[model samples]
Target: MPEQVKLRDGTDTWVLALEPSDRERLVAGFEELSDESRRQRFLAPVSRLSEAMLDHLIDDVDGVDHVALVLFAEGPPHVYDPVAIARIVRYPDLPDAADLAVTVKDDWHGRGVASALLPVVIRRRPEGVTRILTEVASDNPASLAMLRRLGPTKISNTTPGVWDIEVDLTAHDLPQPIPLAVVPPEELDGKRLHPVLDAPGRHALRTRDLICPWLN
Candidate 1:
């Protein structure tokens, strides 16, 4: 079942795991992309979705290895229009990482559709997969912001206008709060501590020079 949600513009929508039967929606989605949009998205001249490409996108999906979350236009469940799709497919050699790809119908640009759908797919990615890899065109601020918003990123490849980066998803796994260190007593054995611990400013540090403030 698709999960009900709303875009940043308050437009109602739903998302589901992409299915092989959703081939028509995939075709329509790709068909709607302008040439520039296609280039920005696929990083090459992708005028059409080749049969092999379609097969891979359609058939190679599994919730674990090739996770995809497909967003639909506002409509009933049975009748649907797929407005966007985000996929995270694990690398065969790098099991801990996956290549991230996201596409939105050209008409839906600037509506916060990808912003809403991207993190969900990343969060839904398998446990062992702690890194996400992708390329974003320098001019495509939308896609760049989408990836950066999810986790800490590092540029792993130097492409002229296109950025090949890796996202450290584990950074999102914040550590459990542990008790802070016990504050050091000002006096050790009834004398000021060495350096008085971390003194405030220059004056404080100067006053803290002695291990213990013993009279000369």
Candidate 2:
């Protein structure tokens, strides 16, 4: 069964592991991303996801070392709108870590979509994967901030406009697994807001420490 997560705005999103059958929805979701969103995600101009890419993303995925999770909004009769996607693919040479990537629909931005999806991806990570790595454009502050909340992170400027981030999942000190599914938004009341939701519009770049280490 798909897990249901409630967003801060009180809307519900169903989270499920992506399967071969979800190719069409996934393509549609990619098509809906705004141009800027596409650039931020793929780090290049992508007009659309090609057929070969779709086939590889769905059919070629092994679901063990390579896992993909997608979030969908409940829609009218027999339909679901894909709103966000997160994936962790084990590094070919790095045994203890995997590469992480996440993207949320433009309209759904700042609604805590990525925040809800991230933990689910982590919890479902393949066994023995203790670290997560990601590359984000230096201009994309929101993503950097979201990652910092996970744990002690190592950030470095690998290229002029790109940064490499490594997060040690085992070092995260969260007291418990975050609840991704539950009814009644009130049930989440009084609970601490996820870092993504707590400080909207803030960027890690604004805080010098996040990027300064590389300069020293």
| Candidate achieving the largest TM-score | 2
Q: Write the per-residue lDDT of candidate 2 for residues 115-148, one digit (tens) a residue.
A: 8888888888877998766667778877877777
State the weakest 10-residue window (summed lDDT) of model 1: 207-216
Model 1 per-residue lDDT at 79: 57
**Per-residue lDDT for 66-129 in model 1, tens only?**
7778787664545556677777777656678777777777677789888788767877886699
The TM-score between candidate 1 and the true structure equals: 0.73
Per-residue error for 183 in candidate 2, Å, reads: 38
| Cα TM-score of candidate 2 | 0.74
Query: Each candidate: what lDDT?
Result: 0.61, 0.64
